[model samples]
Target: MNDNSSRPLRLGTRRSKLAMAQSGQVAQAVQQLTGRPVELVEITTYGDVSRESLAQIGGTGVFVSALRDALLAGEIDFAVHSLKDLPTKQPEDLALAAIPPREDPRDVLVARDGLTFETLPEGSRIGTGSPRRMAQLNAWARELGKEIETVPIRGNIDTRIGFVTKGELDAVVLAAAGLSRIGRSAEVSQFLEPDAVLPAPGQGALAIECAMTNAPLAATLAELDDPYTRVAVTAERSLLAALEAGCSAPVGALADLSPSPDEQIVTEMRLRGVVGTTDGKTLVQLSITGPVPSSSEEAVAMGHELAAAMLDKGAAGLMGERAL
Candidate 1:
């Protein structure tokens, strides 16, 4: 291993407020772990500059390619990424060094006059950049016998919330983890339950990546890895890969420990997945419970099992993509 003992480690991250905040937290943890100085290296990504929606720009890796380039170029020693934004496919040259414990993976609403989704006036406009959120929200509205317009939007938290503040939209939906990390959770009007709307795969998690060749650094970073978090997200992302869906696709997945029959110790896990059209006309949601995976292989198998069941129920047809 190359000697990195005397030099500061460079942590590449995007230039967004949320990105910087999360990266800073990780940097602090890394410094304490390795007793070495850490530096933040901000890189601009195509997703940050493009006015086009994520789906329009090929959402899977738009925000991540530049950072990966920096890692390969040795401009940064490592990078921190919002796991949800990462592509399901891991490159051969890089190593996912660690995944720390996750935050709350639910979606939250910020509405005008402190209004909840159910209480929002009829025909209210709800803004969000995620097709997953739109599909579920519209479906819920239909169940409530109310009308809501899910407007397509793309921007940082401020820009998205501005629409509501400026009266251009009635509310905007965002990840609960994001608002909490930025000390703005107090502004949330409602926390969207996962029962009604599962979050995007790996939604509340962070991925720390390093060059696969950097064995020493990778080992050091691995100290931060949380096995439970890794296994859960692995199952979720595996389902995403099995579905052959990009991050922009209207797919949501979540996995958690399931209680035993006695409702005491947890020895099993439950994985739930959803696929729907952007318009919310149809949805295929299914779940599977099995032993808590002790290895990545087991978790992946569980996801494949669930994906197969969903496919049998026309999940592929809903994604408008290739048949699996």
Candidate 2:
């Protein structure tokens, strides 16, 4: 997987501050792993240019299409993406070359007054546009018999958090990974537990993609891959696909590798999945744990099995309400 040439690897990235920061980290890591120089190629995408909200623009392929296009067109040798932004279906011509070690996979609350999900006052308003978060938050609030409002919001982390400073909203929910990526983790008031709010599948992960034709490049990129992280996210994304859920749908899944404590060797991998309506009226959740995965296919199969279990418990009807 050695690059004999001196040319730098062109890493395509969206031109947002967050995307640039993410790409910069990836570029350094890939360069160190492959012994290849890496360059960041900024690309403007429909999602970045559109004034419309994420729901209006459609969700799955928004931020990623331009990068994929650049890769397919040979404009960039490789690209990086927030794995959650990627669709479940893989393209025949493009290969997901690597998924590096993930960051914190849990969501966080950036609330005023250092408040948390449990400590937030009754009727407190929370801001988030993600159906996955909204649904789970609503369901939890209902279970607690606390009447909190979930406001729809769209923008970068700074803009979303601004609502609290401007007194436009009480609080906002954001991924812990995003805040951490930009060195803003200090701003997080509280990290929500996964049991309270299951994170979007592949929330804290990155997808490195390259054209399928580039075997040498693929091998180089694969050197940067963390098999455990890849397998875990594969299980999560596989659940999403088996459920026929869109990336924007109120579906959340998290997979973890639980190694035996004494030996520090992975013994089992557990996956938990949730499906719910936007209104939080109906929610279906399931979990499955078995032997540690030996291959990508086994990990994906575990996710499908969990999805089927949830579907048997009326996960489909809960998801159906999302369309209505």
Candidate 3:
């Protein structure tokens, strides 16, 4: 560890409970590894201040720009973010220093009175604001010949859960990782498998960002980087980048690392792209698989190829419409 006894490393984070919890974990890790004190600074972001819908507020960058501005201004030494909330592009001065071990990268169904998907009544109301989730749920419901209504719901995890508990909605879909981080995993009525609901890119992972010039601090963060998580998330993000999809785009991807007998890890990834009308009446989804990419560039290329295939099949037209 570099001798920085004079100044503690300042860690910037959003004020949300989950964000604080994740930042606390990272601060603790850095403190242990570097033998330095870490200071937590709560920063308010546009996403927190604006009442506008996420898509209306300009996609996912609202949550990240403030924290990134602080980093660039040297107001904080590092920052933590929910990887899924990050945009596909990175700023010139900032570097994604680390991707720690990922949590469960699956969406969960939370329903009132412990009801599972199979048991929910016909015409039951589900709540979620994600176009990706809405599309998948609609497609699956169609396959089952089940008539269910998806209601647009948005807020923090607690607020979203309240919709179900308060009898406003029969169920809601949320990231299993978010629930688990907040110690509310028990609220999950069912863990939707990847085969049924592919997760958004970089879900369940935490991103550490720091200024590119901060070599010493960046090196310290490197200790926390999990290679498996990095590779998997890299591929997923690459796919997102290739598609030119923002965080709100109806794109999902999951990557798995299968180790070969020769002790080499083979990267395998599946990408799912969806396009849907605003009313959720029609949707087109495409899935593609390829060998794990050797680099972020390669992974991005694979994602681009898959996206091109989907577009050729008229995905662009479907996405052009509003998705509620």
**lDDT tens per residue, model 3, 1-324:** 234676898999999988988899999999998888999999999998887766676566889999999998889999999999998778888989999999999999999989987788899999987877877787777777788898877788999999998999999999999898889998899999877777888999999999999988898898899877876787777666655667776667777666566856654656565555544567666777777666777767766777778677777666532222
lDDT (CA) per prediction: 0.92, 0.89, 0.81
Q: Write the per-residue lDDT of candidate 2 for residues 1-324, one digit (tens) a residue.
A: 134568888999999888999999999988888677899999998888887756666687889999999998889999999999998998999989999999999999999888888888999999997988999999999998888899989888889999998888889999999999999999999999999899999999999999999998898889879999999999999999988877888899999889798867889988999998877888898899999889989988999999899989998877632221
**Candidate 1 per-residue C-alpha lDDT over 204-229 given as tens digits, one digit per residue, 9 for 90 to 100:** 99999999989989999999999989
> Who is ahead in TM-score, 1 or 2?
1
TM-score order of candidates, best first?
Answer: 1, 2, 3
**What TM-score, over all chains together, does every model reach?**
0.97, 0.95, 0.92
* Per-structure clash totals for the candidates: 0, 0, 2
Ranking by lDDT: 1, 2, 3
1 or 3, which is superior by lDDT?
A: 1
Q: In model 1, which regions exceed 4 Å deviation?
A: 259-265, 320-324
Q: Which 10-residue window in model 3 sums to the lowest lDDT?
A: 315-324
